[model samples]
Target: MWNKRRRHFESYPEIVIVHVSGYGRPESGGDPKKCKRGCYDIISQAYSGWCKLASTPEHEVYRLPLYAGNYVTALFGAMEMLVAYIHAQKTGEGQVVDVAQFEAIARIIEMYYTQCIITLEY
Candidate 1:
């Protein structure tokens, strides 16, 4: 879904902006050992692909931050959205949607490109 959306936006340059949320989540389920392995595999694949595509001569794959504060990130995201909306209203253009965690996760997979391509599910 994300790739399709990206392509759509690329094709239609009139898409002035995009506001996305809930892109931070643990991408595995159940037992801790399996979850960790699964998460590692998923992240490794993503990083591998990113490394292949990156145009910069030098690249670094940084680890995700381990924050002690539980809701601080979410609060920051809300503040960002608020500021973006105000800016958009002042400028009189663009759109904003409160994307949920599940929706955001679903979009990250390459296979899910068809979801956005064939439906408005996102």
Candidate 2:
């Protein structure tokens, strides 16, 4: 189904295709078994360490009160789409934007951790 759509879209150079998934392209890396699994907000949070960051003092972890993973994934997906669209406009060639929800959440986590590390004294 995706292959067919990709082929069809190949003719439309101005179109920017965005593929958002839980893990990412199966051929890329990670557990192939999990690549077949679909991910939701809670799943992404758990896999991406968001739940750990949101854990209570007792070490009881939980999903964010809101669906932060979903929203963040969407925001990142949108950003990728826009950047790909701009590239396509300039090159007159369409491109696929592959966004993994896990990576998107991890990016936010990594960004926060990096900032903390930079500010830490020891």
| lDDT by residue (tens digit), candidate 2, 1-122 | 67776776876757787888999876556578888898999999999877876676676887786888989999999999989888888998777678899999999888666654787421
Q: Which digits, one per residue and each the tens of the lDDT, describe model 1 over residues 1-122?
A: 56765676567533433333233323222234432342332343343342232223454543223421213334544665677667656775434334233233333444545554577343
Tell me the spans in candidate 2 whose CA falls farther than 4 Å from its real position. Answer: 1-6, 27-30, 111-122
Q: How many clashes show up in model 1?
A: 1
Model 1, position 21, has a per-residue lDDT of 29
lDDT of each: 0.40, 0.82
| lDDT, residue 37, model 1 | 42
What lDDT score is found at residue 111 in candidate 2? Answer: 67
User: What is candidate 2's CA lDDT for residue 82?
Assistant: 89
So what's the TM-score on candidate 2?
0.80
Candidates in order, TM-scores: namely: 0.27, 0.80
